[model samples]
Target: MTLLPGVRSATVDTDRLRMHLLAAGPEDGEPLVLLHGNLSTGRFYEHLMPTLGERYRVLAPDMRGFGDTEPKALDATRGLGDWADDTAALLHALGIERAPHLVGWSTGGAAVAAYAKDHPVASLTFLDPVSPYGYGGVRADGTPVTPDVAGSGGGSANPEVVARLAAKDASDESPFSIRNVMRALYWSPTYRLPPEREDVLVAEVLKTLVGDDGYPGDHAPSPHWPGVAPGTRGILNALSPKYCRWADVVDLDPKPPVLWTHGSADLVVADASPLDFGVLGASGAVPGWPGEEAFPAQPMVAQIREVLDAYAAAGGRVTVEMFEGSGHGPHVDAAHRWTEVLLAFLVSA
Candidate 1:
């Protein structure tokens, strides 16, 4: 399909899996890869892509079993690290070995971090929870350990939403919990949503619950990592349990200027103070999202403070910005503030 700013995409085979990546902008332009959240595909960015495409070479590829891509063999072992491998393969196939800017959201944040640590990404722009929620970098062979998402609540807690979602199994389709949580988002829903946009995100609910073909594009999934290759199920089995713990992964080295923004209202993964993440320097107060259950649950606020403080003290180039009246994905949910910061980061960084 036609993407923002005349950018387009098609499926290519890197190895076994079919990969779909945005094919927009000049081939030689500086590259920027957009990674989506878990259980989400690149399709979500259909509306947001154009904003970035106006200036940079943008590519948003769907991960395995998500979005437009077809499901893999599913021995079922894939986890976060494999995603990094997928990025590596994508870059290799595209002949891009040098570092490029990566704007990763949610789990995509973790995947990109893994890529940056090993490869040369120009920088990382993180939105909301930085990554792996602590339960990262677990060795595939290590014993499986459930991540301490005990803090999945982030730094804020919306008790009403919690009780509502907890009450019913919406049906196996939407995964009772995920659907209910998302329910608050829609009054109407989305289908042939627009720049059109969906109201209340009804269509997304139907698909997630109904298992419809979300990505109706002509392309296939990326093969860079493996199309449920020999080791996918193994990867999933070893890593799924540890995904939300906030301790397993840390940014040992960050390349590309990092711009991070979280909602003052986010309870899922409240961010450290602006001074900590470098968003505002020592001039601002450390914002808190008491409603979120993620960070506070695992001492995330303090941990983030420690990291931000250490990074700043160490002269790390990071920025932590905030938004009010919003939650985790301020970019998608509260586009104005997010877009301003994002555009600034893209141009300035």
Candidate 2:
């Protein structure tokens, strides 16, 4: 199962724009697109894909506003809709008439859901993602609403509820916390980047960050800092773009195998990814609005259960699995268990 064997780069130009992607696996195999979480690019799946082998053709694109594809098109407003359009264009450019299996993490998950709904994907996976509400932010029982901002443990009063929702996770507070250097190593869980590497990471993001189109480069930062930092709000503020709800597109179509994953204890996206969008309203990430508290973790934890439900409701083909005790990108961040879960679900599909 050596799926994505190495770093392979290609730029696919749609009639609308050019998309840069790092890919691996058999070109002729069943197609699968790995959408990275907000902070990094598709390189995040660099390890996970190598194990999938020829089982599927895996393409991890630097979405319109991310990675090498930065300085996105005016059309590429960092809006999830623009992300979906590029995804569709990428498929069409590659002659993938049938939608491949779509696996989205964090913001990418939101993109996957918005696109796969109408795109005819074989299956869908929300890999430990934040759906706008608390996809990555909640506990199984629902407690800490924010993972980044320092909290008095008081309810949110920040213009945006999510912004003030800040609280640190155990890992973020650990002496070994990976937060400071995470941007440099998309796939490195045990590894941390040195200063030189950190410099490179910053340069990379900055270089691809803004385009001649006047649209700023895409750099999705984490919602919270791991350690208690005073500038958590400032950091988030700098990273955030004007809010555009990806959930608004969910109603466009709804036919596909939908799988959602989230860590009950994840402090990253944390229930931020909206499952329903509450009729298409903004979450706390927007400026000038109070940050919203996350949904109870019980329902968030039920994503896998919902996948099973999708299976039961849709006959034999099931579309969901739970990555227990995992954080962020389950298959990549918590590969040991979630990888197995991913394989099982793929085979099931």
Candidate 3:
């Protein structure tokens, strides 16, 4: 991968795992930890880090199962705790005594939330994070569609897509190919990554470990319409509501200021996310939706707003910014504006 000038790569052995990271800026600069989402690595932030490095010590680590981090099975039952704790351990190991500004993208947003709850942080910034409740198969109130939380987690991952990822199929011939998936889903459909940058991002995704303990993880059959439930292990299951739930973050002691930035066009974590099985089935995109009551489209954005509103009501500081034209990865699709807003938030915080 072609790294920006001043960016360096290293592996730090924390108590929990060996975290491979891309770091920039002065070692003594105020720390800003950038956490990437699922199917991505620290390299995902390579371009964003350099500018931020001018003012902050930027460290972006590939969480346990992705990139150069040692492959380790995530204990899905603990939800995002594994990732949070790993992040804490890495900070401590690196001798970062003060709480760093935490920035998380997508699933990484869930990780930072879990981290902020159990640990102290200067501030929290979520870039199109998953809902405070979890992903799909749940109501606006966070109740599961089925008792087992069917139609969510690892089982919800498309088998064909997972297979392509496993095979490291870089071809864009099919929608399932990693390249096409990134091109079609990772950013705004109207905006495309430059060829070289796309190559690097795709390579970073291919580094993910693919198995029951890896990317999509494991699942079990369910009686629900979608007919699948979270298995007991792996990254995808770790995101399942059965394991991941952080609505109580509003109650976190020493509540930090939260800056939530999202794209109005984000399809991955929207009220009617296209990636959500319930939405797909309901829209006739997938057969046998079983209608709204049995399996309603997950109101992911609403769930996040509800929790954030509660946080505000509870006397915590929160700000929301919606980028109109960007998709899931606004930092990429709307880089200049995203950077300006993000920098202003960091500086003011």
Candidate 4:
């Protein structure tokens, strides 16, 4: 809601749906699109736009089912293809014919990778991205442990957190409150966003759609150990390995330069993430884990490395930067350093 100076807001109409976006810099400058992750709006990149916009036309849009974008039904069956197609439509609508440099955070990282799988891009920067194989239900080798992909997707979301989000509980009265979750998981527990900025982010998260057509989407009963599988629709379902996978990006023709930046202390997308069923099962948090051999914690970061390494092996330029002690959000926790590295890479890319 709070726009830093020089940032402008706009509503652009694309064929698929109307999109709300934040943009800065000259219209004629090279285009640079920043995609935010799940549970966040384009506003999450507000602070970064000014710097990025100085040299490029920076645009950040609220993805479908999040922020002010029209709450269209997301087809999880298409995986991130819906989002990738949406970005293409938005770019075409904006009259941007040239492939633009892209930066994606968390879920947005997968979104950008999906975009690159079928489109040309000037460059790609992944910030603590989800695994190339998807979020959960996969082994270290990116293979699904169960046929139904149990313990992943919409049903895997904590009901208490979803309920709190639906209630718009901004107060930090409960551990699951939006504000508290943001503080605890959005960044390293040791770092804190300024009060005003934190308020803005919490407000943005509250605007997210919360049901089958949105955040956690819907779930179906599964015969597998965890007993739940991703339904055919919603954001989380789109992230399930059943439908989501971007490792194919490694095979793109005229492959673009890639920069993978991550925080060492990331908890949201870690091998031992508290949200992962395998981790929960290992910790005795989820009963009947079925033992490690049957289902081990997903090696999220390692999967990314393998995919990116394959990308490099296939002739794409790749760079990896790890920010020690930061949490899931390096852009928020290590803004200056992240910006510096990104700008340098963009110039070379």
TM-score on alpha carbons, each prediction: 0.64, 0.60, 0.98, 0.99
Per-residue lDDT tens digits of candidate 3, residues 104-166? 998898899999987889999999998888888898899998999998889888889999898
Candidate 2 structure quality by residue, lDDT tens digits, 1-349: 1223464778888865777887777888888898876545666666666776447788888775457774454332343566777789888999887558888877676677667545777777777654332222233432333544222111111222222112221123432223442422233344344655444443433323322232222223334422121121211211122322333323433445456666544544433323212111244333332234432222443443443454455453444555555545455456667767766777767
lDDT for 83 (candidate 4): 85
Give per-residue CA lDDT, model 4, range 248-306, as digits (tens).
88888889999999999999988788889889999999898899999899999888898
Error of 1 at 243 (Å): 5.9
Candidate that beats the other on TM-score, 1 or 3, i.e. the better one: 3
Scanning candidate 3 in windows of ten residues, the lowest lDDT window is: 180-189
Q: Which runs in model 1 stand beyond 4 Å of their true positions? A: 1-5, 73-79, 130-180, 183-196, 199-255, 270-296
Clashing pairs in 4: none
lDDT of model number 1: 0.49
Q: lDDT for each of the candidates? A: 0.49, 0.50, 0.90, 0.91
Q: How far off is residue 27 in model 2, in Å?
A: 1.3
**Better candidate number, 1 or 2, judged by lDDT:** 2
Please write out the lDDT profile of model 1 over residues 1-349, one tens digit for every residue.
Answer: 4345675867767664677766566667788888876435576665666766667677788765454544543222234555677777777788876678887776576677667667777777766644343422122222221232121111112334333333433432542344544433211122122433442232322322111111111111323211111112322221232332323334455435767666655544443422111122223332332232222123334454555555566666778887766665676677656777887777777
Report the alpha-carbon TM-score of model 4 versus the true structure: 0.99
- For residue 268, what is the lDDT in candidate 4? 91
